[model samples]
Target: MVTGLTLLHTSPAHVPVFDALRDREHPGAVLRHLVYPELLERARAHGPESVAEDLRGLLGDAGGPVLVTCSTLGAVAEALAPALGAPVLRVDRPMAAEAVRTGPRIAVLATVESTLAPTAELLAEEADGRPVSVRTRLVEGAWELFVAGGTARHLAAVAEAVDAVTDADVIVLAQASMAGAAPLARTRVPVLSSPGPGLAAALRLCGADTTAAPPA
Candidate 1:
């Protein structure tokens, strides 16, 4: 039986994305995916705090080292870690930390408006007193395309937004869904995505050996 990491996501699209990542990074590893689309709807309709009760209930059955793939709920997941009695990780954290270490000027690109604040806040926390500047850009209409199952168009829009940010030392893709846009972005600045780094962290947290995984 293959047992490794458990992922909590607000969208079903993430299932394939992370599944593919695991196949490439940790071949033959098994992953459990728990997607709750309503969680995101409720969070966006209300606020991050409003999802706390629902999240707590949902996470009650989740296994350790659960990776929350929604950027808007990243902070809440981290906050609930202690109470959850399991390792709850936000997908963007590892990417945010890496962005902080990469350069002083960081450009964060997101499709969802709610993702902007959480991502920027996480980046600042990762900076840890370092003199780093973060600029956030929301790709207009990209989320609608993604919701309508237009993956290619959504990626192209995000890539265009990435290319528009000319003053950044590094570009950070705020949402895991935005990872696909990284390679499509035609820019000199390094584009950092969450899945690779987030999966690595999830494996570590779950006590899975990552020696065979490719270098980041």
Candidate 2:
């Protein structure tokens, strides 16, 4: 079994994305969820590193390499990288890079306020001094729908939020949980999700080819 670790601020939003990527390498892989208390808003205020340490403590002795997933925990992930000695699956970096590459006017949508700085920094770095304009917005109360089992409704609200940031060439869902709403966010704009690049990187780091499905 190919086991991994995921830190979820809400319900199983990251699970489907991970499962989709896992199926390409380890079909029916057993996923271990390290559920931390809902830290969406708190993550920004308290810092993600502390939360990551809390998660690391929760994952005691669960062997095999692990991948930590978080949309708002980039700083925490960077801090935890050395300790975990495993690839930390931060959703913002790649998504930001992709958004910058696609367009100058980028819209970043997130539930947490802390995600903006790191995301903006990453986009600026990827733009290579090019005059790329970035616009960011926050969507409050959307993650609640996912926790209430209203995945579709939550996604639609996210799409509506993305639509609110009009005249942008690309839209980036800063939260991994927000990734499930990508299909609905297709409004004449390219919507990028963390799972696509994050999972691809995870597979490569695990020495697996992402092209073929994992063994059943």
Candidate 3:
């Protein structure tokens, strides 16, 4: 039986983000975060397939549902899910489904260029025969700020990107790291972030009680 949620992340920065989410929403939920910065670097230097073995190595022992939070590696993880023993999920999928339900026109914003294609494809898949149009925006240079530990500036750039897309019915933050920008964005349309929805999905997949009361 599944005992907790296992989060696979390419950056260590995501640890606190999802940890805080579990604390606030799931309180007692067990969450194990495996962060490997080199995984992303190798994927960027080579290709997504390059990390397939590495991910398979890490996931061989992961308990409960495994959530892959990096958009660049999401597809690879998903492709390996059936053989990985545990339930593996891409973090942005829930958000993508929500975006498709919200409207036909969707805007996918990503700080890194690599994230756009994967996220846009996820949205298209989620459309499930519905007519959906997706627009992608790459917040150029914002990823540099994020890597430099300037989260506030990264979020500012993302928020600006969000405001620039005025024609979309809903804006999707392709990276879980970009979620902070959602609240700061002053856009007319709804902004969707992955972390919350992703965690909820992971909990459900693991058979955890998502509606459980939070710690006081």
Candidate 4:
């Protein structure tokens, strides 16, 4: 099935990563990418309503399932989902669920401050009153590197930020863009990527066979 790849970052680097991952988990699936690099900055400076308006506009024209990949916009996507005609899913939902399961102590890592609250809220909602603790860490100066097209440096900074998690059962990578940082981090705790599980959830919601999807 065709899927709309909604993003708030302008870089082409995330495209190949998502493509490889989508193909690996669901071969031959069609994808249409839509990116607006300044969307998050707007959300941070302005508010989600402004971003949601654009998201709603995109959803109106999207032909198939829509997967919003920006962690900062996850809450906005979910808020807009019920009103849309097609399936609208946030990339971090599944990962947040998995994090709660591993939690009591979960550390969420993000390069942007706009991402932390929404991510933490999602984890809390998924926690289901069984006692889950969330700690948010911002990888200092990382977002600037991304804006400057220094992806390798941006990812390296995120990996280095993992060192700040003093005690945690698992670490949650708040953005799909941070997935690459997992292996680069020098941490013993399990690091989970949002997009992998998110795509899996989207495929399942669409009634597609996800037999090719790898284990978490």
Order candidates by lDDT, high to low. Answer: 3, 1, 4, 2
* Minimal lDDT window, size 10, model 4: 1-10
Instruction: Quote model 4's TM-score.
Output: 0.90
Off by over 4 Å in 3: 212-216
Q: Which ten residues in a row have the lowest lDDT in candidate 1?
A: 206-215
In order, candidate lDDTs are: 0.88, 0.67, 0.89, 0.79
Q: Which ten residues in a row have the lowest lDDT in candidate 2?
A: 1-10
Clashing residue pairs for model 3: none
Point to the candidate with the largest lDDT.
3
Q: Model 2: runs farther than 4 Å from truth?
A: 1-10, 24-32, 38-45, 55-65, 213-216
Worst 10 residues of 3 by lDDT: 207-216
Give lDDT tens digits, candidate 2, residues 1-216: 344444333345566667776666555444565545465546757765546666565433444344556656665655566676655555566677778879889888876667777677778877989889888887887766767778888888888897777798988888787887777765878988887676666555555554655347
- Local accuracy of candidate 3 as per-residue lDDT tens digits, 1-216: 436888999888999999888878876788998988888888878888999999888877785579999988998898887887678999999999999999999988998787888888898899988999998988999999999999999999999989989788999999999999999988879999999999889898988877659447
In candidate 1, what are the lDDT values of residues 32-106, reduced to their tens digit?
A: 999989888888888889898878877767756688999999898789889888888899899999999899999
Candidate 4 lDDT, 157-200, residue by residue in tens: 98888866788999999988888888898888889998689877
What's the TM-score of every candidate structure?
0.95, 0.78, 0.95, 0.90
